[model samples]
Target: MDRTTDIIIIKSIDQLPSVDEIKSISRERALKLVFKENINRQREEIGQYLDDTLSGFLVLIHKIDPELNIVKLITDKEIEDHQNFFEQCAKDYRQLGQKLVFMLVDKLDLNLNKDFPLDTFNELKRDERQIGKVAEWKYFVHGFHCGFQNIITGQYIEVPLVFGLEFGDLDPYFFVKFILSSPDYHPLPIPLFEEYADGLRIIEKMVSLGKFEKIHSKIGGHDGTVVTDREKVEIKSNLDLEKIFVNHIKEIEKKSKFNLWKFLGLKK
Candidate 1:
């Protein structure tokens, strides 16, 4: 297929592409998306639902209502090469519905490849690729240390390093070891401390969002903090800590007696 051709087009969740519109597109372009290694009746069934005359390409339309999230596509073969594509599509659709917003295709595919090359998404040239049109086109490569910072200065920091964002999904131990072992890079003494801090930020954000009461309970507490009976019960109950943390932060901010800087060990 010609890279110049706009094979797949992304529309707002509110707007849907009809099966006839998809069928009108060239067959080869459609087939590239839907074809699979092994033919499955399920694919055909989905195709039938989208369009009766699915000659060259099979059309799959998955609509998640309430959020009005929709993914409409035509492929010549089944999606057998990689499972990540379908999973990402589903996740994107779900997120659209939940957030009631549009997000870049890259964010949707964060979990698509556990090991996709970092430069796979980096564009070699401008105008070579359409941003939101192409389905499988590379978009952006997320940096390795997305939120890294210097501890003493509390300033955002970036090491002279570049890693494929795909490693973000794999087990952290392997990635951490790889970074530490690299002869070119001198890793911080307390690498795990940074990871823990990042995790804590996520937990604190969750608490602020009112998603759960106690995140430490679910993750077995922070540092060596013991899980009390109440925390254990909350963990067993699977409570959300996001909102709790949000409220807690608000309360702390309002209290003049509390000193968060000291609590964070940043104050002298």
Candidate 2:
């Protein structure tokens, strides 16, 4: 239960840790990347997969738990699959976002006052807690404006990323809002939409047949101490987790495009 996940940047492969390898994302800071300079254009680049070879020394350490390293309970294949999803969304070298990849679900009320605490919601806006190691579930990636001019993604937590070279240009305002060319708020052309729909249909069947795996990780207590309790939680850290969205929350679907009214719920 004392497992931990950390990012270690090294100038050379010699710095690789002896512990079981989780996964790593490294790219040369000098590598040229073409992305929109603003939010509007970035939207147009959706459904693009990352196939770039990084040149610099960088790493991304996700939430994992082993008895010793605090690795997740999922298998290695699942871990690699999750990392692929991250790399695809985190296509740009810049890291400056907060988001959630939530599962889709059937009708069920949020069970909260629809007045929807404007003030609370506003406060929630400043929150920075990320749901960790939550792939393997049927979900969509909820991206925020990540990759900032300042502040490295995992700097505060001291992600061990070594840079033997200088940094390079990155997508200025990259947004992680692509769905395999699926029409977002703006609908795609019929041909493109059809392609996306067909791909999604296959994925739906695969998931229904349990093609994907599920992972589990332990949540820490308020004081940063690991805890086993899974309910009635409150964390007063910078995360500002005053009230969780709803314990074991799921998005219950109802609208054409995914929205709050339609969101996910745990399958009974």
Q: Candidate 1: which stretches are off by over 4 Å?
A: 1-28, 31-58, 61-167, 170-268
Candidate 1's displacement at residue 38, Å, is 34
In lDDT terms, how accurate is model 2?
0.23
Shift in Å, residue 147, candidate 2: 14
lDDT tens digits by residue: candidate 1, 35-127: 232433244454455555544332344332111111223221222222233233223322222221112225444322212222233332234
Taking all chains together, the TM-score of candidate 2 against the true structure is: 0.16
Pick the TM-score winner. Answer: 2
Which numbered prediction scores highest in lDDT against the true structure? 1
TM values, all candidates: 0.16, 0.16
- lDDT of all the models against the reference? 0.30, 0.23
What's the true lDDT of residue 73 in model 2?
23
Error (Å) of candidate 1 at residue 233 is 28
